[model samples]
Target: MRAAVYRGVNDVRVETVPVPAIGPDEVLIRVAACGICGTDLKKIHTGSHSAPRIFGHETAGTIAAVGERVQGFSVGDRVMVFHHIPCGHCYYCRKKTFAQCEVYKKVGCTAGFEPSGGGFAEYVRVMDWIVRRGLVKIPDGVPFEQAAFVEPVNTCFKAVRNLALEPDETVLVIGQGPIGILLASLAAQTGAKVLTSDLFPERHRIAAEFGLRHPIDAGKEDVVAVAHAASEGRGADAVILAVGGNALIKTAMNAARPGGRVLLFAQTQHGDAVIDPADICMEEKSLIGSYSASEEIQDEGAALVFDGYRNGFDLTRLVSHRFSLEDAVAAIELASNPGPDSMKIFIEPNLAQV
Candidate 1:
């Protein structure tokens, strides 16, 4: 099997590796489509997250082989894999903070090294825990490309659930990347007036197509002022920082209303971010950080993804380019490049089928 192994910073190679063998309670998935995520780029660029890692978490495929003990799944069944599932009895899990769970910290599913997701390969071994609790069956009509979106959409759904959005409130979503656009769309569904902020005109234009009423270009206009005017001088009722840059945190805080909530949907890696605690305390504003998805929300998220596609979400528009597994490096390069046109890039492990 050919797998794109992460060697080091800015280095990824497609090399022939032994096909992964499934355990008695596991299953083997023949990879179909894997999405190149922002986290993968961050790991490659910053060296904050290292290599010799197979780092694709958003993936969809067909079951190539099912382990002896595996049930309700068989060869040729379409599926989407989630690499992490929390132990529901843990302290963090009990508090609904699944990402913080000890079991969740250790990746449960993989094709190779470090238990990081290995969807870049032609085959991945879905571990027993995940097979029993995390794997989702893709409906017959849904395409693999769309099913690959389940994991990412799950993460955004978790953030939306945390927001507890009010019907009459307004939401300002910073950054109009794939995840940002999804956030805007979901926030709009909650009856909130959605305002999208991004430097790229294409992204803002796409936000309009996603039902965002107000799209502001942060590069040319003042985001804080636009948000203020949209909310009748009170500023946005809530702000979601979908971009991970340190500077965006401050912008999100400033754009939110006095008693509003600010959700940090990204910024997973640690860094010094300058923020004023006084504003949070005095204004009675709350700053919350959301990371990863949970088993509790996975079913709902998957249902939403299926429903979104059936109801004309046009998620395929988010995918701007597709590359084969052999061109995995090129895919990563395109994803890393900050461009107005590039949104989501997909790597088809089974290029022959596509």
Candidate 2:
């Protein structure tokens, strides 16, 4: 099988590798389509993970073979595989913090090497735990590209749910990237008026299709000022910082009304971000952070993805580019250096099918 093996930081190359051998407790999937994620890009750019591994994880495919012990799944079944699943008995799991569960911290899928997300290859092995509870069956008529969004959709939905949005509230989503669009769209689904900010006009145009009526071009005007105007001179009821930057933290805080919530949706990398204590103390603003997908809301997230598929919230519109497995290097490059024209970029191992 051909896999894009990450050799080192800034280096990934297509190489012929052995097809992963699955145990009786696992299954093999013929890769169909995998979305390039921002997290994946961060891993590649920062050398956060070791080399000689496959990295793509936003994946969907047809089951090639099911293990002898695996039940309720068979060859030819279309599925979206979750690379991580939490053990329900753990302390973190008991508290509903699935991403922090010791078991959940382990990667449950791999191509041929140490278990990392192995979706950037021709075939991948799905471990037993994920097969039982983390796999989602893609409904008939939904494209692989759409199915590939399930995990990401779960993350976005989790963030929106964490906001505890009220119907009368107004939301300001900072950024218009694919994840940002997902965040804004999901926030709007809760009946909140949604506003978006982006430097790229093209991204703003795409966001309009997602029911966003207010778009503030951060390049041209003050985002805080625009958000306040949209919120009827007070400020947004809640500001979701979907793009990562220390500078944007203050912007999010300033754009929220007194006592309003500011959700940090993208400060994934570990670092200290300087924030104004006055925003939290004097104004009584709440600054919170949400990360990863939640097992408790796994079913709800899957249903939301299906709802998006049926109600014209089609996620396929976010996919701006697709490349075959042979050209994964190019796909990674484009996803890394996103411009106004690019949103979700995918690597389709089987382009003919997707």
Candidate 3:
């Protein structure tokens, strides 16, 4: 089988490798479509982690075979793979902080080193623990490309859930990238007045099409002022920081009302960021950070993605480009180069059919 192997910094190659062998409690999936995530780009560019890993996590595929002990899932089931599932008895899980559980850090329901999730190949080995708890079956009529969105959508769902948004409240989602747009769309479903901020005019336009009431171009307009005006001078009830830049966190803080909450949905790493501690102290505002999704929320998130498609979430519009596994280099380059119009980029492992 051929897989895109990450060798070193700025290096990924489609090389022939031995197909993964399934354990007695595992299942094997024939890769269908895997989305190129921002984390993949960060890993490649920053070299924050070790190499020789397979980098994809947003995956959708069909089951090729199931281990002897795997039940309920047959050889022909369509599925979406989740890389991490928290141990139900962990301290973090006990507190409902599943993403921080010790077992949550274990990767590879299907691919790459340490089981972090290696969906960038032609096939993946779904480990026993994942088969037992995290794997989800894709319903009939759902396309593989759409199913591939479940993981990311689940992450956003976790953030929105943490926000505990009210129907009449206003939400200001900073950054209109794929994740930002997703947050806006989900917030809109909650009956919140969703406003989006982005440097690109194209993203702002896209947000408007997704039912966003107000789209602020941070490059050309004051995001704080726009958010204030949209909320009738009081500022939004909540601000969702969907972008990872250090500066956006401060912008999110300023865009919220006095007692509003700010949810940092991105920023996987710690970095120097400026914030006024007095703002939280005096104004009584709150800043919360949300990370990975949980097994409990995974099903909810998958249901949300499926329902979004059923109710016309316009998810496919988020995909601006598609690349084959053979064109992995080009895909990475495009994802790295942000223009006025780029959104989500999909990589089809089975591009021959597409």
Candidate 4:
């Protein structure tokens, strides 16, 4: 088998490697489709994690082997797998903060090296706990590419629900990338008037399809002004910062009205962001952050993806490009430096087939 092994900073190569061995309680899945995530690119470029690991978590595939201890799953089962599953008994789990759970934070799936995400490889060993709780079987007609979105949608839906949006309010979402579009769409579904801002006109065109008529070209227009204008000069009731970079924190804050909410949906990386305390203290605005997916919303997220698939939302349409596992490096480059047309980049290990 061949896996894209991360050797060092900004280095990944497709090298022949042995298929991962699984424990009695584990399951082996042959990779079908894996999406390149921003977090994966960040880890690869920053060397945040040790090298010699395969990193890819947005994965969907057919089961190649099932452990003796595994139940309700067979060798030919098709599933969308999650790399992390909370212990469900820990302090954090009890509090419903699953991402912070000690057991949940540990990476449970791997290709050949340490237990990092192994979806970039030909096959991955899914630990027993995840096999029991984190894996969702793909329905008969849904494609693997669409099934792969279940995890990401969980994260996005988590953020939207946390915002506690109102149907009649106005919301501004910064950045019109895949995640941004998902955020805006979800917000609009709540009956809220959603405004999306992006420098790329192509992305705004994509946003328009979601019924987002007020697209703010941030590069050429005053996003804050437009957001205010849409809200009768009071600014948007809420603003979700879907793109990373500490610099956007201020812009998101400024786009929201006094006493409004600013949800930081991106800012996953640890760093310092400059902000004025006056914005929160004097203006009474709330700045909040949401990270990862919530187990409580897993079923809802999966249903949303499957239903969206059944509808014309066609989440897979966000996938703009596909690359074979052998050209994983090129896939990373394109995703890292997205053009106006690029949205979601996929790595189809079996691209030659379906």
Candidate 5:
């Protein structure tokens, strides 16, 4: 089998590696489609993790082997695997903060080397705990490409739910990338008037397909002014910072009403952000951060992705490029430096089969 092995900082090499061996309580999945996530790019550029790891997590594929102890799942089932699952009895689990659980911190899927997500490889070994709790069967008639979005959708869904959006509220989503679009679309579903902000018209055009009408040209127009105008000089009811970096944090804070909520969805790095103390103290604005997926809403997220597939929420339309396993390096380059045309980039190991 071939895998894109992460060698070091800003270095990923495609090399032949052994097909991972599964345990008696594990399962094996032949990779079909794996989405190139922003976190994957972060890890590659930052070298936050050790070398020789396979790091694609947004994965969906066909089951090639099932452990003897695994029941209700067969060898031919189509499925997607979550790399982390929390122990239900932990302290964090009790608080519904599953991402903080010690068990959840451990990666459970691997192709070889350290147990980073192995969707970049041709096949991945799903560990015992993941097989029991994190494996999801794809519904019939849903494409593997759409099923690949379940994990990302769950993360975005968790973030949207955290905002507790109201039907009459006005929300400004500060970005127009794939994840940004997902956040804006989900916010729209809550009946909130969604204003999308981006520099590229092409991205705004793609967002229009999801019924997002309000667009703020971040490069030309004052986003904070646009957000305020939409809400009658009070700023938006809520603002979601879907773009990365600390640069936009101040803008997001200024775009929200005095008492409105602001969600930091893409500021994953541990660094100081430019924020006014008055925004939270004097203005009574709330700045909250939501990271990773929530197990509590896993089923709901899966249903939205599966059922939405046929109900006109075709996520595949977001897929702008698909690369074979051999061309994964090029795929990473494109995803790392996205153009106005590139939306969601995918690396399909078994491209012909899919």
Candidate 6:
């Protein structure tokens, strides 16, 4: 099998590797569609993790083989796998912070080396724990590329749900990338007026398909001013910083009302960010961070992805490029440096079937 192995910082090469063998309690999935995610790019450029690992996690495909002990699933079933599942009895699980659970931190899918997500390869072995709980069957008639969005949609949906949005509220989503569009679309579903911000006009045009009306051209217009204008002199009730890095943290904070909330969805990197303490203390604004998917909403997220396809929420339209396994390095490069027209990029191992 050909897998894109991460050798070191800023290095990824597609090389022939062994087809991972599954245990008696595990299963093997022939990869169909795997979306390139920002966290995967971050790890590749920063070398945050060790070398010789396969990193694509937004995956979906047909089961090539099932373990002897795996009952409810069969070899021919179509499914999407979550690389992490939390132990229901852990302290973090009890508090609903599943991402921090020790069991959840361990990657359960692999193509060959270290159990990092193996979706970048042709096939990935799903561990026993993931097979039991994290595996979700894709509904019939839906495309694998759409099913590949289940994991990312879960993460975005969790953030939107955490905001506790009201119908009368106004939200300013800072970024119009695929993830940013997902966040803004979900926020609009709650009846809140959504204002999308991005420097590219192409992204704003794509955002309009999801019914997002208000768009702030971050390149030419003032985001804070546009947010305030929409709210009648007050800033947005909630501002979601979907763009990566800490450069916009202060801007997001300033674009919210005195008692508004700011959700840091894409600031996954840990580092120093300059924020005014008086904003939280004197202005009563709140800074919240939502990361990863939640097990409690796993079923809901899957249902949304499945049912949404038939109900005007075709996520596949967001995919602008699809690369084969041999061209994964190029795929990663394009995803790392997105242009105005680039939306969601995918690597389809089985392009013909998917």
**What digit string (tens of lDDT, one per residue) describes model 1 on residues 196-238?**
9999999888778777868898899999999999999998889
Which of the predicted structures, 2 or 6, would earn the higher lDDT when compared with the native? 6
Which portions of model 6 show Cα errors greater than 4 Å? 352-354
lDDT of 1 at 253: 90
Given candidate 5, what's the lDDT at residue 321? Answer: 95
Candidate 4: where are CA atoms >4 Å away? Answer: none
Q: Provide TM-scores for the models.
A: 0.97, 0.98, 0.96, 0.98, 0.98, 0.99
Q: lDDT for each of the candidates?
A: 0.87, 0.91, 0.85, 0.91, 0.94, 0.94
- Give Cα distance to truth, residue 234, candidate 1, Å: 0.6
In model 5, the worst 10-residue window by lDDT is: 345-354
- TM-score of model number 6: 0.99
lDDT of 3 at 222: 92
Model 6 pairs in collision: none
List where candidate 5 sits over 4 angstroms from the true fold: 352-354
CA error at residue 316 for candidate 3, angstroms: 1.9
RMSD of each candidate relative to the true structure: 1.5, 1.5, 1.5, 1.4, 1.3, 1.4
Candidate 1, position 205, lDDT = 81
Superposed Cα deviation of residue 191, candidate 1 (Å): 0.5
3 versus 4: better lDDT goes to? 4
Least well predicted 10-residue stretch by lDDT in candidate 4? 345-354
Q: On residues 37-64, what C-alpha lDDT tens digit does candidate 6 reach at each position?
A: 9999999999999998999999999999
Clashes of each: 0, 0, 4, 0, 0, 0
